[model samples]
Target: MMLQDIDAVIFDLDGSLVDSMWIWEQIDIEYLGRFGIALPDNLQYEIEGKSFSETAHFFKERFQISDPLQKIKDDWNEMAWNKYSYEVPLKNGADSFLAYCKANDIKLGIATSNSRELVMNVAAVHGLEHYFDCIMTGCDVEKGKPAPDIYLAVADALKVDPSRCLVFEDIIPGILAGKAAGMKVCAVEDAYSEAIRAEKKELADYYIKDYTDFSSLY
Candidate 1:
């Protein structure tokens, strides 16, 4: 909806604010290949909303990897660094929408399942570090999306009531997390989640193909 109705706007980083979802699947394939394990077709769906740490744990247990969890995370971060630094781009019109939010004095924050290092790298790449009031990762909370912990933690960090916050997300679990936190949720369209568009529309209060769509709302 309109900016006037919300005091804060929280965003999910990966598919929501940037076109980087493709990188993860590539990483998963490459990483698992290193262990001589074939990538499961359902792997992405299985780990949809899990935190970085949780995903590492899943990989460790599910694949029976011998490496410690931290090593797994570190290796992933290393593999993803160059790609995120070079290839990932912000979603269409995201910069302008961030600018609009800044101009309107609306607080902004990121509640992402991604690691803090990666999310920060994304901000640096797009010169978006200054746009956020808070940048929280799922590791900061006990649970990830669909449980509402990360979004709630972010709202608390921003000192805003959950009801006064609006969330932009691109996946079903993220939309569910925002709604569970009592915030209005806007489902963002991303090719990675295109197959589940109808479920997203049904679950979210609003849906947009890109940040540019916000222009029509006002």
Candidate 2:
């Protein structure tokens, strides 16, 4: 009832449900360091919500790095696999919120920019594989966040109307994507995106500091 007749809840993985946004920052620093290139101060903002493949391309073009896109992706995937499996922890109240959805018979799905292998591996490691009815990646769609494609795909897979889905996201692009898909978007607070929190809040239909802030809705 609090969710106002929402039939499904879709989540963005990295910052919304999992405390794993640091991995990308670490990867950016280390990856560019190998080439003796310093990571730019605005680099994080530049690629904040891009898909893995789009990020690889950005690195290659912006940094003038010689590595191929596939190579960069492979390297990042290998580097992140360990952290995702063993170190990344779920966000506070994330488990509880997921349980709430299940108990209330709300279909759940994941619309993520992460690679499929890493996503599945992390899910398996955390024993979260069964929590979602559908898990879709940016790669599964033609375009990533800010395009509405990924979110739309998840809605399609879940057989839910876009208007009946509630999306939780931690970044601006994701919030925009959800809105573009005709769903209500809630911006989940994440430290990595703190600087742009106001923008996110302005763009999203609602904002939550975490899953605990259920005063508005889940």
Candidate 1 TM-score over all chains jointly: 0.97
lDDT tens per residue, model 1, 119-197: 9999998899999999999999999888899999999999999999999999999999999999999999999999999
TM-scores of all predicted structures: 0.97, 0.93
In model 1, state the lDDT of residue 190: 95
lDDT of 2 by residue, 69-145 (tens): 89999999998989998899988878778887898899999999998888898789878888899999887888888
Error of 2 at 62 (Å): 1.8
Where does candidate 1 stray beyond 4 Å? 216-218
Error of 1 at 72 (Å): 0.3
Question: Candidate 2 — what's its lDDT?
Answer: 0.88
Go through the candidates in order and give each one's C-alpha lDDT: 0.93, 0.88
Clashes of 1: 0
